[model samples]
Target: MLQINDLTFDAWGRRFFDHASVSVPPGAKVGLVGRNGVGKSTLFKLILGELPAGDGEIGYPKQARLASVDQEHPATPVPLLDTVLAADVERDRLLAALETAEPEQMGEIYARLSEIGADRAPSRAAEILSGLGFRQDDLARPMAEFSGGWRMRVALAAALFAEPDILLLDEPTNYLDLEGALWLESRLKKYPHTAVVISHDREILNNSCDHILHLIDGKLTLYPGGYDAFERQREEKAKVQEATRAKVEAQRAHLQSFVDRFRAKASKATQAQSRLKMLARLPPVSAVAIEHTTPFVLPSPDRPLAPPLVRLEGVTTGYDGVPILKGMNLRLDLDDRIGLLGVNGAGKSTFAKLVAGALPAMTGHLARSARLKVGWFHQHQIEALDPDDTPLDIIRREMPEASEAARRSRLAQYGLGAAKVETRVENLSGGERARLLLNLVAAEAPHLLILDEPTNHLDIDSRRALLDALNDYQGAVILITHDRSLMELVADRLWLAADGTIKPFEGDMDDYARFVVERAKQAGKAPTQIRAAEPDPPPKPAPARAKVPTGPARRRAEAAEAALARASQALADIDRALTDPGVFAENPAKAADLGRRREAAQAALEAAELEWLEAVEAYEAMKG
Candidate 1:
C-alpha cells in the first residue's frame, strides 16, 4: 500500500500539488491520468524517490520493490532474454552466493532460490517476451541486433521480469503495436501486485485500471472504479460545485450592493459597515479550473485533389536493397481513409516513409499526380525540429512566403498560445511539441497525409480533436496508430502492413481488434497450437511462381517442416479423441476436455503455419 499525505509540490514558481492526499490500496491498478505537463510523471519520480518532495509526506512499504520501464540499457553484448532475466537481482545474488557459500549457508541459499522460483527465471522471461510479440529466435538475439522500437520492447520486457511490488508504467503503450498493447493490458489485468499506469490510451485505462487518479489544477482526486466511472463521478462532482458556486456568488453580490448603496449615507452607516464586514467574510466561490480545449484545425488543400493521388505497382522498397516491403501494389484515391495495422517491426513505418517519398523505391514503378502534395507526420517527428527554434520560427521557416498573420493563425489552431509560440521548442512539453509538428503538416495543405503514430504523445482530448478534424477533411489519409479508438473513428478502410506487403484488410475495426488479441494469445501458446490461422501470402509476382528455398536455408526449411509435421500428428490424436464415442460414454468430462484442448491446438497450428510461411518467403527471396 502507498499513502500520500498532504502533498505539496512546487516547480517553476507554480504549485503543481497543494495539500493533496491519496491512498493506493494493495493490488490496486490505478490509472494516473491528466493533461500533458500536469506533473503526472513528476509524481511517479517522487514516489520512486528520484526527486525530493517539495512539501509532503509519502509512505509505502519499505520492502516494496519499485519497478519502472528503463529507457536506456548499457552497451553490453547480452542476449535480450538474458538481459531481461537479469533484472531479478535477488535471483542473481542468490545464484552468485551459491558458488562460494559456507556449508551451513548452502542449504539456506538453495531454499531461497526455490522460494523465489529462480530456476524458472529464463522461462518466465521468455513468456513475458512472447507476450510482447517476440519470436522464438529473438530470445537468443543480442540487444544490439534489434531496432529502436524493438529495443524499447526489450526494456519493457526487462521491467516486467523484475516483478516488483509496485509497477510504475509511463506511456507503456507507445512502444507496443496493437497486438503487444492488447497482450500487455491482459497481463496487467492478471498482475497480482499494485500498478500505476500513465497512458493516453483510453482502452488501456478503462480495461486495466481498477481506480482512476486524476491530477487537476494543483489538486489530486482519487475515484473508485475504472476510467468511465471516474468520468461520471467527476462530472457529478463538477455539477454540484457549480450550483454551490452560483449560490455563493449571489449572496456575495447582494451584500456588496447593499454596502455600496448605503456606505456613504449617515442614517444607515453602521448597517452598511456591517454589510461590508459580511461581504468580506464571505468565502469566495471555488471556480473550476477551465480545461484548455483547443481543437486542431487542418486547412484544406489549396486545389482540388485529383483521384488516385499516388499509385505503387509491384513496388519493392527497402534500405540498401534489403527489402522490408516487397511487391507492394497500392493506390491512394482521393479521400481514402486507410488505417495501417501490424505488429512492431512489420514495416508499417517503412511503408509510410516510402509513400511519403522519404525513401527511394528499390524496384517496380511508382506514379504520382503532377500536382501531388504530400504531408507527413512520422513518429517522433517533433525531434526533427531545431531545438533552439520556437514554434513561430519553425512555421515562418516552413512557410516563408506566408504573411505573419497566416503563420500565427496556423499555430493558434494547434492550441499554441501567444506566449508559447516563441518559447524554445526544447522547453515545450511532449504534447505541445506534438501539436507544433501537426501544425507543420497541416499548413502544407497536402492532398495526401501520411501519419505514423501521430497520437503517441497526445492526450485523449487531443486525439479526439485530431480524429474529428481528419474525419471532416476531404483528403486521402494513411494513418498508422496503436490507438484503436482513433483508428476506428477515422479510417474507412484498413490496411495490414505485414508479411512483406501492404494489402487491404477485409474486416472491420472490431474484427482487427479481435485478431490482435488472438495473435497475442497465440504468441504465448505452444507452436503446435497455432497452425490454423492463415498467414497472408506475399503479393503475386509477374511470373506467378515463387523462388524455392535452397542451400543452407533448406536445412531450416526442413526443420520447420518436421516440427509442423509433429504438430499435425498431435492434432490428429486429438481428432481421434473427438471421434471416440466409447471414450465419451465412459467419461463424458474427459471427452469435453479433449474437445476444448483440440480447439486451442488447432489455433496453435494455424499460428505456426503463418510463421513457417514467413520463413519460407524470406528464405526464397534471399535466394533470388
Candidate 2:
C-alpha cells in the first residue's frame, strides 16, 4: 500500500534516513519504533510532504487518502459528532451535492452513498468517540467546550471515522487513560485499512500490530509479527552476523601472519603479495554496538513500615465543597502494589493527592501512621520545574546539608551525567527531566510511593527501567498510567475510580479491556435512546453469542436507531416551527418551506423505522 525507495534525508548536519527502503503491504498494521531522536516523526513529515527528502522516492496509490492526527482538532462551534462526520469528505460532498443535484445525477449519488453506508456514519462516529472516552452527552457538545487533550481525541476519532486508506498515528495513547487505551488497542486490532503507528506502549505494539518496523542508524528493518517476535529475530540475526564476523577475522589474521612471515623473503614474495590481495578483498564487517539504557535510581526505604500504612473510611473529598470522590474506603499496606484505573477526570489524581496529604478529606475519617513517609511523583511535577534552573541547582536546594560532590553524585544517580548537571531544565529532554524528578521524589526512600501517569514522557526502554526500579524498591506503590504493559508488570492489584468513588476492580487487564469495549458499545446506544425519548428495553444477554454481540451486529443496530432518532427529531423540529402563527400569516414562503421539509422528514421517518426493524432482526439472527 505504501513504498519508500532509496530514501535519504539529511537535516541539521545529520542524516535521518540513508538509502532506507521498505514496502508496506495493503491492510497491514505496522508499528514504527526506534529510540528517541531517531527521526521517526521526521519520516512521517516526509511522507506527508511537510518535509522534502534530499534523495529518493516515497510513493503510494495516487487516489489513496492519507490521514494523520498530528495536532488537536480545531476548537470550533461545531458539535463533536458533526465534526467527526465531516471527516468523511466523500460522504459530506455527496450529501452537499444531493441538495442541488439535477434529477439525472441523483441516482449515481444515492448509489455511491449506499455503497459507502453513509446512513450509518453517525453511530460509527459516535462509537469511535465513545471508545476514546467521550460520553453520550459529549456527542452534542461543541468542540470549543473540550480541553486540548479531549480535542486531540476528537482528531483521532475523526481519522478513525474517515477510514483513510493509510492511517498514521503517533503515540495515540499519550493523551488517553487506561480505559481509552484499552479500547483503542481493541479498535486498532480490528482496523481494516493500513495503519502505521508510532508508539512506545509495549502492549499496543505487541497486541494491536501484526508487523514491527524498526528504524536504527538511518536504516529501516521490517519484521513479521509483533515486538517480541522482532526482538527474537533481531537477536538471532545478530548472532549469525557476529559468528560470521569472527570467522572472517580469524581467516584474515591467519592470512596476515602468512604475509608477515614471507614478505621479507624472495622465495615466498609472490604468495605474500597474493595474500595481501586476498586480505584487501575481504568484506568489512562493522562490530555490533552495545546499547545501554540509563537505570533509574529509587532508593529503598531505610526501615519497613507496619501493615495498614494508610486507611480511609467513608472518605469524601473535593474542591470548593463539591465532592469529586465520595464514600471511599481503602487501605494500603507496606508492600502492596496497586494499579489505579479510570478515565480522565474520574478522580484518580485527586485520590492520589488525598493520600499524599496535599488535600484534606471533606468528610469521613482518614488515618495514617504518624511515621509514614510518602513520595509522590505526578505528571505535573515535570512541568512545575523552573526553566532557568539546572539539575545541579535543584539538587543543591534538595540536598542542602550534603557537600557539592554529594549533590552531583545524587544527580548522576538519577541518570543526569556531568554535562546535564549544569544544563537548564528547558534544555533537558522530557525523559531527563522525568528521570531527575522521579529519583528526587524518592531519594529519601519513603515507605510509600504514589506515582501518577509517570511513564508519559519516558520511552519504552526508559519505562522498562522505571518498572524495574519500582519492582526493586521496597515500598508500597500506588501506580496510575496509560501504559498497560507497565501497569501489568508493576501492580499486583487493581483499583478502579468510577461513579464518584474508588473500589477494587475484580479482574485482570484482559478482563478490564473487555469491559472497556463493552462499555463503549453501550455508550454508543445511549445517545439515540436519549434523543428519541423512548429508550429501548435492554436485551437479555445471550450466552451462546456473547462475543458476536459486541461486533458488527450491535453497531448496525445502534446505527439504525440513531438514524430513526434523527429522522423523528427532524420531523418534530419542522412541526414545531410550523406551529408559530407568524410563519403562516406573516411569511407564506417560510410556511411553504416548512411544509415541504415536514413531508420529506415524514418520509424519512417511515424509511428509518423500516431500516431499524431490519437491523434489529439481523442482530437478533446473529444472537441465534
Candidate 3:
C-alpha cells in the first residue's frame, strides 16, 4: 500500500534519513519503532506526500485512500462526532441526493443511484463512533468541551471512519487510558486496511502489529514478526557484532605483538615484516562503544515511620477564587502507594504541588508531620537543576555530608561515569538530565516521594529501571504518570482525580481501569456495553462446633473488636476531611481550623487502621 526507495530527509542541515527503504504491503500491520527524533513522523509525512523527500522516491498505490492522525488535532469548532461524520463527503452527498429525489425521476434515479451507491458506498458513521468509545449522547457535544486526550480520540475516530486504504497513526496511545487504548488495539486488529503505527507502548505494538520496521541511524531494518521478535533479533545481532569485534581485535593484537618482538632480529625479520604488512592490509573493525546501563536508585528513608505523614482536610484549591479541587480530604500514611490519575490539565500537577508545599491551598489546610521529609520530582524536573553544574557537582552539592567515594559511587549507580559525570548539565540530553535529577533525589533519602510525570521523555530502558526502583522503595509514594504500564507495575492503589474531587480505588490496576470505564459510561462520555458474569462457586459447608472460650481469649477478642470499631470511626473522619468544602473555599482561617481537625482525624484513623490490621491478623491466625 505504501513504498519508499532510497528515501532521504534532511532537517536543520542534519540528515535524519539516508537512503532508507521500506514497504507496507496491502493489509499489513507494521509498527515503526525508533528512538525519539529519529524521523518516524517525517517518514510518515513523506509517504503521505506532506513533505518532500530529499533524494529518494516515495510511492502510494493508485486509487488508494490515505489518512493519518498526527500528534496535534486540526483546529475546528464543530462537535467531535460531526467532524468524524464529515470525513465521508460522498456519504453525505449520497444521503442528500436520496432525500431530494422526486417520484417523476424515480426510474431514472434508481439506475443512477445503484451506480453511485456501488462506487461510493455510504459509511457507518454511528457504528464507527460507538466502536471508538463515543456515546450516542456525546455526538452533539461541542468539541471544545472535551479535553485534549478526548480530542485525539475524535481524530482517531475520523481517521478510522474515512476507511482509508492505508492509515498512518503516530503515537496513538500517548494520552489514552487503558480502556481507550485497548479499544484502538481491537479496532486495528480487525481492520481490513493496511496500517503503520508509531508507538512507544510496547504492549500496543506487540498486540496490534505483525511487522516491525526499526529505524536507526538513518537506516530501516525490517523484522518479520512483532515487537517482541524485533527486540529478540536486535539483541542477537548485537551479541554477534560484539563477538566479531572481540575476535578481530584479538587477532590484530597478536600480530602486532609478533611484529614488535621479531622486527629487529635478522632470523625472523622477513616473517615479522610479512606479518606487519598483512596486519596493515587487514580492515579495521569499528565497534560502537557500549556504556553500562543505569539502574534506577530511589532514595531509601533512614528510618521507616508510622502513619499520618500528610493530611488534607476539607480543602479547596484553585486560582483567584476559581476552584479546581473542592472539598478534598485525604491522608497519606507512611508506605502508602498511590497513583494519581486524570486527563491532561486536570489538576494532577496542582495536587502534587500542594503536597510538595510549592503552592498553598486556596482554602484547605495542609498538615504535615514535623519529621516528614518530601522529595519531589516534577514533570519538568530537568529545569530544576543548575545547567552550568556537572552531574557530579550537583550530587555533591545536594549531598554535602556524604564522602567523596560515596558521591562517586552514587553517580556511577545512575550511569554517570567519570567522563560523563564531568560534562556540564546543560550539555546533557533530556534523558541524561532526567537520570541525573533522579540520582540527586535518591541521595536525599526522603521519606515521602512525589513524582510528576517521571516517565516523560524516558526510553524503555530508563522507564524499566525507574519502575524497578519504585517497586523496592519503602517510603510513601505519590506517582503522577501517564504511562499505564508503569502504573500497573508500581501502584498498589489508585486515586482518581476528576470533577473537583478525588476518589480512591482500593484494588488492583485492572479493577481501577474497570472503574474508570464504567464511570465514563455513567457520565455519558463513553460507549457502554453489558458484560457477562462469571460462574459462582458452591457454598462452603458449616464448621464443626467450637469448644468453650476461655476468659483471656474472650477478652482478647473483645479488645480486637473494639479496636476495629475505632479504626472505622477514624476512617469516617478522614472521609469528612476529604469532603469538607471550607478548606477549598476562599477563607484561609476557617480552612486552617478544618485542616487541623482533619489532621487529628487522620492520625486517629491511622492508629485505628494499625490496630485493626493487628486484630485481623490475630483473628485469622486463631481461626487457622
Candidate 3: deviation at residue 465, Å? 3.2
Q: 255 in model 3: Cα distance from truth in Å?
A: 8.7
Please estimate how well model 1 matches the true structure, expressed as its whole-model Cα lDDT: 0.80
What TM-score does candidate 1 get on C-alpha atoms?
0.78
Better of 1 and 3 by TM-score: 1
Question: Residue by residue across 219-330, what tens digits does model 2's lDDT show?
Answer: 9999999989998998998988898899899999999999999998999999999999999999988776566788988888888777789999999999999999999999
Error of 2 at 529 (Å): 4.0
Best by TM-score: 2
Best-to-worst lDDT order: 2, 1, 3
Clashing pairs in 2: none
lDDT of 3 by residue, 1-624 (tens): 677899888887799998998877789888998776678888887887788779988888788898898754565678655677677666556556776778776666567657645333223454455445555566676778777667777788788877788999987765554446655666677788999998776666777888888888898987878788998988888888888888888989999999999999999999999998889887776685443447887767988666789888988887777888888889987757788875545678888888888877888777888887888887467777678888778777777998988888878888777888889988877778887776566656888898877766676667777887876676878988656777766665577676776766444445544444443334333222222121121122223322221222333555666776776776676667657676567677866776677678667667766766676676556544
Q: Please write out the lDDT profile of model 1 over residues 1-624, one tens digit for every residue.
A: 989999999887787888989989899999999998888888998898898897889899999988887475654689777788789898988888989999999999999999998877776676687778887676667888887777878888888888789999999988887768777887888888999999988888888899999998767888998878998998898888889999889998898889889889999899999988887888777886667668876777878666678899999999987999999888888767788888777899888888888898899998889888888997657777778999899888887999999888878877897889899988998788987788678766788888888888899878878887886565778888878777766776677877778887666655665565555455445432223344333233333333231323433555566667877888999998789788788998899899898998898788767767876886677666
Better of 1 and 2 by TM-score: 2
Against the true structure, candidate 3 has what lDDT? 0.72
Candidate structures ordered by TM-score, highest first: 2, 1, 3
Error of 1 at 189 (Å): 2.0
Would you estimate the TM-scores of all the predictions?
A: 0.78, 0.84, 0.64
Whole-model Cα lDDT per candidate?
Answer: 0.80, 0.88, 0.72
